[model samples]
Target: MTAVFDTFYADDTLVDHLTKSIQYSIQSGGKRIRPLFLLETLQAFGIPISEAHFKVAAAVELIHTSSLIHDDLPAMDNDDFRRGQLTNHKVYGEAQAILAGDALLLDPYLLLSSADLNASVIVALVAELAYASGSHGMVAGQVLDMDGEQHTLTVDQLKKIHALKTGRMLTFPFVAAGIIAEQDDEIVALLRQLGEAVGQAFQIRDDILDVTATFEEIGKTPGKDVVADKSTYVKLLGLDGAKQALTEYLDIASQMLTEIEHKTQLQGEPILKQIERLRID
Candidate 1:
């Protein structure tokens, strides 16, 4: 993926300069966690990816990337760095960055709905993605985070902040996968819980990284949360207490996955592995 991205970015020999500029920043490093979570959730449900799932999964990744691009902008987070490199706006110029981010945001739906997935599944996924990426989901969370600056919030309030900002979008893939796989209601519910827990753990880990991680390790500006003065579990609770909370969430998430009984296949699912790792710290 990284190599393809690099080559894709370097394809300036044929494309227009503006396109090249946007592609350069848009094709930067990312963990691809959203697709991975969706894939694992589908696997846990004993479903194989059809051609349609792949398209939708790719859409999931595109949306996640789009959010990161906007999040790194000077106006949004005033961030100079992202994915361990200069932000899109830093290298591409503000105008090109805006276009690139907008292109990514708008492009994925065409990609997802373009293929052979059932109309119902596509519609549901689109609605889920829209909510997650829009005012109710990731964008909502960002607004809360921005509003939270310089203000102390209760732990519940902080969770609410991240649940909308970070958790909902992260959880979207799981819900989307459940819909794609046509899982039972109980199983879908389990995936939802697992995803929320995963999002919370991921955010807490990010909070830890902000304080304990180096700028090089994170590839983006560290300690921005501190500068922003956004409330975090690490702020309300000590590092050790935050770690404890992560463990509890991970355990809760793992137990929720037991709904698909005798489904021994889920034992090695990557999402489950992620939950165990989250428990580690």
Candidate 2:
């Protein structure tokens, strides 16, 4: 991935500066969970890892990085730090940061379009990615989250927010893999459910960490939810109740994975192990 970004641009000074900003954003270490999820889903289907798969994975990361850059803007979360480093807008000017994010978001479509895969597969991937990242998905979640600030949110409302904001993107890898591997609609539906469950658990853990983990421990500003007065599992459920919710989502995710494994008779241990690591306790 670093190599891809290294040669992502040419020698013009202005272009070089812009590319550098994008590179800096990508080079900053993250969990890389989204791409890993895609790869693992492919592996479970016994699909050979190919350059196309890597391209798809890179596309996913680019979209995620773009979101982070935008999310940290002064108009948004206004976060000054991410992944234990200064936020992009803090390092680069806000205009550059915004453009960089916009560039990153659009580049993925170019990648997917040019990938050496069947037209059908590429089309399916593009459609799913657009829906996941667009208004009905992550954007919707962010709007709801922003709107819910300074006001208490019901449990169902909170779940709906996370489900759109976090869960849709998390679920993309699995659904994309199923599309590439030509899985049936029933299997694809199951993968979507599993993705939703895992996404909910993932967000709950994030809420728990906000209250319980330190900045150094979590690699981002801690307790910002409270400071921002954003509605989160911790704010609504308390620490113990939020934790209980995490367990329930994890259990649901695990059960769905087991069902997928049994139905497909595939070795799902790799993905299952990843879910196990999400346990808050």
Candidate 3:
């Protein structure tokens, strides 16, 4: 789980300030979930991870973390703590945080393009990653999330927001793994299901936390969702019902992985293993 991020982070005279800011922001040590998913997904397909895996992992994490930086700005989610430290906008000023986020988004492909992977593979992965992290996925999800808070939403409406904000990024590794491993679509689909369920459950946990956790324990201001009066699972179905939904979908996701264990033995990955292990028990 300890991956070095040095190579993907570098010095550029032109973007010096932004680079420093982004690097500082990344150095704060976030969960590294997306990159872990990408790495583990590749490993799940029997790819022996090496320096290249670390490189790709860093690139993915940088993209994800950069999004968080922009996401927490005054115009966005607007809070203080991120990755358990001062958020980029709070520490670097809003403008620098913006440029840092832009740099982080573009720099990953630049790094990936320069990597030792097959040219076409790198290009396609870069393009797909950009699309998923950009307008078609995470960015779109954020816009919808903002809009979601502005009004009440039905279950379908909330699900759409989760599919983008939480699910797409989670599903990303499944597709990226297939691309890198040359896997069949069927396996990729199963993995996507697992990823989405993991994300949905994770989002539900977040909602539960919003109601239950404190500003100190959770490392950020608590009850922002309550403040927003946003229609969360808690607001929609009640807390017990929300937890049950998380459990039910997570169980369904666990069942999906049974089709793959005979091959990949992917049960070693923490997130995947945790879900599957829970289901089996």
Candidate 4:
């Protein structure tokens, strides 16, 4: 994956300074869970991972990185550190950071278009990704989150926010896996459900960590959710309640994996393992 990124940025056509800034953000360590999920889904579907698969996975990571960069800006979370390093806006200046985020967002389409896949497959990947990342998905969710900050929200409303913001991107991997594996709509729908369950669980865990984790554990300032007066599972439900919710979501995810395998006869162990790893305790 890093090799793919290195090769893409190695092109001399890109501006040196801009590329460097983008690289700095990308190279900053992250859990890389999104791409790993995509790969695991593909593997679970009996699709052999290839360079083409890596290209698609990298595109997902690029979009995620872009979101993180923008999420850290003064207008957003306004954080100084991510993954235990100064944020792009803090290190490269706000203007450059914005540009860097924009580039990361835009580059994914180029990566997808150039991937070694059929024209129809490429088109499908592009369209779904655009939807997942655009107004109907993450952006709309972000708007809801920012708006929710001003008012206490119901648990359902909070789930609605994250189902788009975080879940759509996570769900895209399953979509891509289904498409690549040539699965039918039924299987695709099942995978989407599984991904959404995992995404919600992941967000709940994040909310739990915000209060329970230290800076070294989370690689950023903790308790920002409380400081910002944001609605989170931990705030709405107590910490114990949030944890219970995480377990419930993960159970739903496990069931989805079971259904997927029963229907497709494909091994879902890889994805099941991922769900198990999400457990905090």
Give the winner by TM-score.
Answer: 4
Model 2: per-residue Cα lDDT at residue 92: 91
| Model 4: lDDT to the true structure | 0.91
Alpha carbon lDDT of each predicted model: 0.75, 0.89, 0.74, 0.91
TM of each candidate vs. truth: 0.88, 0.97, 0.90, 0.98
**TM-score for candidate 2:** 0.97
Rank ordering of all candidates by TM-score, starting from the highest: 4, 2, 3, 1
> Which stretches of model 2 miss by more than 4 angstroms?
7-14
lDDT of 3: 0.74
Report the lDDT tens digits of candidate 1 across residue range 1-281: 34333443465464475566556654665677877777777776678766667667777676677777788877878898887788878887887777777877776787776758789888888998898888888888888888888899899998988788889878888888878877667766767777788788778888888888888888988888888887888898978888887777777777766654344345435667766765543
Query: RMSD of model 4, in Å?
Result: 0.9
- Look at candidate 2 and tell me the lDDT of residue 47: 93
- Model 2, 59-129: lDDT tens digits are 88898899999999999988999999999999999999999999988889988987789999999999999
Count clashing residue pairs per candidate: 2, 0, 0, 0
Worst 10 residues of 2 by lDDT: 5-14
The candidate, 2 or 3, that scores higher on TM-score is 2
RMSD of 3: 2.7
Error of 3 at 44 (Å): 2.6
Candidate 3's displacement at residue 47, Å, is: 1.6
Instruction: Show model 3 residue runs off by greater than 4 Å.
Output: 1-4, 12-14, 262-271, 276-281
Q: What is the TM-score (0 to 1) of candidate 4? A: 0.98
